[model samples]
Target: MDKRILVELTTEIVSAHASVNEMSREELLDEIQDVFRKLNALVGVEG
Candidate 1:
């Protein structure tokens, strides 16, 4: 996987979390898990 893509995706997830005001702890955790899943899938892709 490209390091740039991983970094950008992480930045996006962080930005999205920072923008959410009403999310509960569990919701935030779930969101993070989702992000990991997405990153894993992207890493699995062959260029």
Candidate 2:
């Protein structure tokens, strides 16, 4: 992935984690997993 895009994704993940403190543990895990899948696709990684 391009550096800029990677940085943007990182920022997005951080923001999501920081802002969704009220979410249940399961929901937060799902959200993090979704972000990882997206980042993997962006980097051409099969997951």
Candidate 3:
């Protein structure tokens, strides 16, 4: 919900994978889930 978080996440996702056109939906979902987990840990994984 935070703008900074959104931007950081988008930047990470885009930088890692370039274009969504090149990644399958499930593959992208997996990458997103991984990034979210890492970000959550950085925030102390509280909620």
Candidate 4:
């Protein structure tokens, strides 16, 4: 993966988490998992 793409993805993830309000634990966990999956894909990791 490109360094720029990784940096952008990390920034987006941080922004998304910071923007959330009043979310349940499960919902937050799911969002984190989704972000991880996206990052993995960006790095060419097989599912």
Candidate ranking under TM-score, highest first, comes to 1, 3, 2, 4
Query: What are the TM-scores, per candidate, against the unseen true structure?
Result: 0.52, 0.50, 0.51, 0.50
Which stretches in model 2 have alpha-carbon errors above 4 Å? Answer: 1-17
Encode model 1's per-residue lDDT on 1-47: one tens digit a residue.
Answer: 76566657876885677696677778777776677668867675345
Candidate lDDT (C-alpha), each: 0.70, 0.67, 0.65, 0.67
Write down the lDDT that model 4 would get: 0.67
For candidate 2, list the clashing residue pairs, or say none: none
Question: How many clashes would you count in candidate 3?
Answer: 0
The better candidate by lDDT, 1 or 2, is 1
Return model 1's CA RMSD, one decimal: 3.7
Cα lDDT of model 4 by residue, 1-34, tens digit:
6656665786688567758666677877776667
Q: Candidate 3 lDDT, tens digit per residue, 1-47?
A: 55467548856775667563577778677777677767666664323
By lDDT, the best candidate is 1
Model 2 residue 40 distance off true place after TM-score fit, in angstroms: 0.5
Q: Weakest 10 consecutive residues, lDDT, candidate 2?
A: 38-47
Candidate that scores best on TM-score: 1
**Alpha-carbon RMSD, each predicted model:** 3.7, 4.6, 4.1, 4.5
> Which lDDT tens digits does candidate 2 get at residues 1-47?
56566557866885677695777778767766677667767685422
Off by over 4 Å in 1: 2-8, 45-47
